[model samples]
Structures are given as structure tokens and as C-alpha cells.
Target: MTAGSHDETLAVLTTACAAVGLDPSGAKPIRLAENALWRLPGGIVARITRAGQHQPTERELRLARWLSAQGLPVVRPLPGIEAPATAAGRPVTFWEELPPHTNGTIPDLATLIRQLHSLPRPDFPVGRLDPFVRIRDRIDAAVTLSDTDRDWLRDRLADIQSAWASLPEGLPECLVHGDAWTGNVACPLAGGPALLMDLERCSVGRPEWDLVSTAVKLTTTGTISKTEYERFCTIYGHDVLNWPGYDTMRAARELRMTTYAAQHAATNPAWRPEAQHRLACLQGHNGPRPWKWMGIV
Candidate 1:
């Protein structure tokens, strides 16, 4: 099923809900990106991903349980439900809906990353961080990209891949939250500790990989103020920007973000302008670092 098909996603949600004995009548879509998230009745949230994602989906559930057991704060899978049920070729999992929460503060995310990076590796197999995963496909699927722009993106991707392979050593490898952004960290409004959400990318990798997500917000995207960025570094106890390999990591991350926008624009035309802007920034049309990039969705 296409990632942008709302009706088709609803059908899959309905089937998955039926399988789990839940009503989908009033399900509300929370997000539609790599995964489709629906807020359902009874404080349960459902996540649906493309077909063939069952393994990773199951790993996310298991990882959540493990993290919770480790006394780490993570969004929990709904109890007593056999999840990753397949419907319409999509994999579905259920999670307990969090209380009304604000997006996490930069410091909140920093703390979570520190905690996550300190954990011992999981016993189960977690594939190494594939920074380039699905990137080529995203480029190819970007309907908004012109042939010339597509070729440029492909060349950029190749260069970044080479750079990534030769990245200098920084921090020791640990459990890295593959995507550690404020959006993935939730601060409950009802008086509770902040919780980490989205385990799809959690894996064992260099802690620098997690730290760079926030670092680039300051150096590349210009989203966070310097004071906030400094606070994040101090709280996390390490500044990725100070690491020798920061350049390569930053380039890889920027490329990924740009391609993500391009891929999204293919499905949602409203994102085309931002996607084109990101592409142009990468191509040097915008000049130098710290280009302003609006968050996409």
C-alpha cells in the first residue's frame, strides 16, 4: 500500500484493530510519515508501517519492554496484546497513548540520549546503524525532483556514503537511539518523567550518532539557539560538534533530512517548496552553513 493512502491505512487499521478486539470507529491520525499513527479509543495508539516491516516492528516492541525493565523511560506497548498483526500487507503494533504531553525540551532529549547511550547492548540482534538505509529509494521515489536534481542528489549521496565509511573515531559504541529528536521524546503534562518514544531506529552504534541529531540543529539547520544547544551539550556531557568526525556525520544527517522531505513531497504536494528549498541548500544555492529549514510535519 502507498504510504500516502489515508483510506487504505484506515482499512488496515480497522482490520488490525478487529484482530486485537478493539474498535476503530473513531480512530484519529496522529502522524503519517515512515509510519502511520492513529489515536484510537481507550487510550491506545496504533502504528502501521509498510509491508515487510514485521521484524523491525516486533523488535521495537521487545526493545520497549526491555528498556522499561531496565528502568529507562520509554513508551510502552499495550499490555496483553499480540502485536505486529498484519493487515493489507502492513505491520501493525499497539502502544498505550501517553498523557497530553508537550514536545520534549532540548535538555530532556539530552538526558534521554545520555541514559540510552549508557545502556548495555541488547541480547537480541539489532542491525548496525545503516545511515543510508532507504535513501536511494527515497531519491528515486521523489516525484517532485527533476532529472537533473535527481542526478545531483545521487552524486551527493555517493559522496556522503564514502565520507561515512572513513569517519574518524569519536565516542565508544553503545545503544544509540537512531533518531533522537525532541519530537521523539515526550514530556507528560500530567506530572511524570519524560519518556522516549519511537524505537524503530534504536540500535547499537556510536553515541556520537545520537548526539549529532541535536548538534546539526544548531550548526546546520539553525533551529536551536546557541544557548539551548550549549545546554543540550552540557546536559549530555559531550558536544558532538567538538568531535573530529562531526563534518561527515553532519553531512549524512543533512542529506537524510533533505531526501526525507523530497520523499514526503512526492506524497503531499504541500511539502514541495520546502523539499526544493532543502535540495537547493544542499546544492550550494543558499550559501554556507546554518540555512533556515522549516520542520516538515
Candidate 2:
């Protein structure tokens, strides 16, 4: 709430730690987003969220544990600790600390994606994400998108809707590590390779959805060359379409992100500028042509 005072935040963390039978004597808070995360000396972390945000935080922690159960290297959350009731009366949760992987090399990164793709789709309707729903929500949340940019999303949505029936379906939907960007992945640790964190976005969907998300992240960040987009498909062994309806999803992703950035701008101004920049690029008005290097004129 009011910028999270150190003493008050520490009290919250201490409560969480005590509930889990750990002493919070020397714990220091680790900044993970707007929430406060405290690290005990021995691989224990308590994440405290104020009222209203606790539910999502709880969901994220559970999802992380579920992913860990699937044997996909992920941070496992400690179970059964109700979020400490603060003056705001919100729920908080804690999780076991995951050591960082020191070897987040390119080969490891490729292997990680390959392993994730190999896993079968998780059964259960976690959520539904359509282009229009995503775009509309972002717009409703007051994300600033130029008229042309908004029009671009509309055209992409129309294309996907029209081609929806023709697109592959029921091939093999599997659990996607939803937000598998490098930010959620850490370098190699122990005898294993890279580790993944932040599973709040996990869902059952076409494997290609995750692949496309990963590819887009890499593409947008210049982590991989434009040519590598096709290489990724080849390596991951998925159907490569002319566009694979990426424009549709990209627009949706940008919209959601822009909304989030705008909502959090007061405390995170950096994100607002980034959101504006991304909005400009998606509108095709103020950035390099993302599809140009792919020879799309």
C-alpha cells in the first residue's frame, strides 16, 4: 500500500516466515516486482502481497509447484501458509528459494525450450486467450495505442478469425510455460541446466503458442537474428506457417503489456516509456520493420 515501509514490510515477512516454522532474524527483502520478497539465510523466501493482489500471487506459487511436479525445473513453493493478515487484511505466501543457474548459455537455452516443447499439453481449461478479448481488455485498461496501431490489431484479429477453422486444431495441445522469456529463466545450476521461475501464466494451449511467444521475445529483444526465427521452428520441430498468425498474437501481447505498463506507470515510469515504444513499433509507424528482414515487403 503506501510504498511499503521497511519496518512494516519486514513485519509481514517475519509473520510469513514464523508461520512456516522459520526464524526471520536476519532476512533481507528481495525486490520482485511491486511485492516484497524476503530471503532467509538458508534458501527460504517469503513473498508478501498486500490486499487484493494475494490471490494472484497464490496462484502463481501453486502453478510453480505444479510445474516442478512435472519435473520441469521450476521454483517450488512451500504450501499451506495463509498470507499474513496485514492492516490491509490481505493474504501472503512463501516459497523455497531456488539457486540461480550460473550457466545460462545459448545451448542451454535452446535445450530448455526443446524440453518444454517435448512435454505433452496439460489437460484442463486453464484459460482462453483470443485476439479480440486480449486487445479489448488492454484498450479498456487505458493502454495508449495509436489509431493505426489499433487498426493493425483489428486486421490481424480479422485474419485469425477468418482462418480459425483452417488452422490446425487438436494436433496436440500441451501445457505451456506461458511466460518463458529469458527473464523467467536463470543460468544453469547444480548438475542440471537452466531453471525457470514465475509460472503464474502457465496454461494449456497449442505448443506453438509458447514457441511463438518465445520467438517473439527473442525477436523483439534482438537476442536472436531474424533468420533464427525459422531456425527455431526447425529445431523445435513445429509447423512453420507464413506468419502462423503471429501478427494477431503479437498485437494481443503488446496490448496486454501496454495496459500493464500504463497501469503501473506511476511507480514504474520506465515501463511506460517501454510500453509507448512497443506500441509505436506495433503500429508500424516509429520503428524498424520487424518482418522486413524475413523478406516480407
Candidate 3:
């Protein structure tokens, strides 16, 4: 789809900038991420998103502040600007922008991911951290799938269900960056080390959950090597067998993503191409079975 009209799209950014006491006119937007990304002068990034109702801005701000306090390399939030409060509207967060990242060396990324997963897993007082459940619920709520797609999803999820059903309750859990893709990671910052962004999906869950997503991201990007995968397993201190549960969740996650893409394709046809690419990947069209993650760890 065509990019939104400059004035029209800028209206949202303008409001967000005004809230932060920044002059939108002076700051030309430069970059955007998967979500609503806007760049301002002086290396500032404003991310306006509307994904979850759980106060993403607040959660992210807390994570950023916590990581910063711990001396972990993390993006710092700009002070003095409260992400706009719109009474249940998703909050927009502003962050201290850094320089462009060098995507070349990824060795640091493996190390950083290990550190992130090392964070103490806190008990969420509100409820259990169940990514699979959330994904399943979304699939149920998503639009009706085509007959062929429905059957494929059903068979895949059934496999996941059987695997999950056999797992004992109270599996060892840890705090993991649920979406630890390469894009979420960046080169070392001049002042510090490499930082991990997109903590919005962070949660306390089985460690394997992080591994599965990380593997999928790496595999899709053709960056993961067998040796590196083994190193990741050793670093995380997890048995390779636990991959079953994670693999199941990963496939389900893809199904949920496909459903979301189906909706977005209505306005952005480009999304359709990406969606097909993901669909083929999930279906194991060009490589080993997607279930390969189940036992390989």
C-alpha cells in the first residue's frame, strides 16, 4: 500500500513529538522498524505501536530502565517525556537512538542472547506465562482459514498439542527475549556493548521457547550454523529434547503470523509476498522439516 500521506501520518508523530517537547518540523523522519517507527533529529526514535492492551510502553520503559540499571547494554529511554496517555490507547515510547548497526559480526549476538536469557525469571502475579496459549487463542480469533490451510494448521498444532500434553507441569522457566531475531540485535554501541531491542514480547517461560524463535529467525535469515546452534544449547544449559515443545510453539506462531498477514494484505500487497515466503518456510518447502527443531534443541 502507498505510504500514508506525509501530513496525515505526521499528525500522529507530531502529537507524539509535542508530548515529548520536540519540534517535528525540525526533525525529519529517517527510519522505520516493523512497527510504527519514526526518527527525529538528534538520534531519537519514537515507536508508536498498537499490538497489545497490556501497556506496551510502560512494560518496555520498565525493561529499558531495569536493564540500564543493571549495566546491561540496552537502549536508554529519553527522560522527561511520558509516553502519551490516551485512556486505554496504546502508549508511544521514545528512546535514545544510537548509530547504525554493523550486521557483519554476529558472534556478539549469541553472547548477548545468552545474557538476556540469564535474567532471573520473575513470577508474573497476574497469570501464567503461556505463549502457546496466547498463540492458540489468536488463531481461534483470527479470520477463518482456507480449507487447505486449516487442515495444515490443524495437523501441525495437533502435533504440538500432543507434545505439550506430555510435558510435566512446572517446567523450568527463565526470562527470555521472546523475539530475539537478528534485527532485534545491533552492533556494539560506542559507549557500551551491543544492545537488544524489542523486549515488548519478553516473558518468563520455558527457556526452549526463546531458542525456538531464535533458531527460526536465524534459519530464515540463513545465519545459523550447526556449531553455533550447539553452542547456544550448551550456553543455555538445556537438553536438546526440549525442542519439541518449542518447535510446536514455533509452528503455531507461524500460523498466527500468517493469519495476521492475511489481514494486512488487504491494504499492503507487499505483505502478501512476505506472508507467502513465511508460509513456505513454515511448511518446510525449501529445507528440513519445520519439526526439526523439536529434537535438535
Point to the candidate with the largest TM-score: 1
Model 3 agreement with the true structure over 1-297: per-residue lDDT tens digits:
135634434566777666657866665554433356667877788766664643656766777777777666777888876454332243567788877775423455567667876776443322234555444443443343455764566676677667666655434676667666556777754545777877777766666656665565444343466677666667655543444455555555556556556445444555655555555666777576432221110
TM-score of each: 0.96, 0.70, 0.74
lDDT of each: 0.89, 0.57, 0.59
Worst 10 residues of 3 by lDDT: 288-297
Candidate 1 structure, TM-score to reference: 0.96
- Per residue, candidate 2 scores C-alpha lDDT tens digits across 1-95 of 23446677777666655656778898876764546677888777776675576555655665665556777776767655544334345466667
- The TM-score between candidate 3 and the true structure equals 0.74
Q: Which candidate achieves the best lDDT against the true structure? A: 1
For model 1, how many clashes? Answer: 0
Which residue window of length 10 is worst by lDDT in model 1? 1-10
Report RMSD (Å) for each prediction in the order shown: 1.8, 5.8, 5.2
Each model's total of backbone clashes: 0, 7, 0
Better of 1 and 3 by lDDT: 1
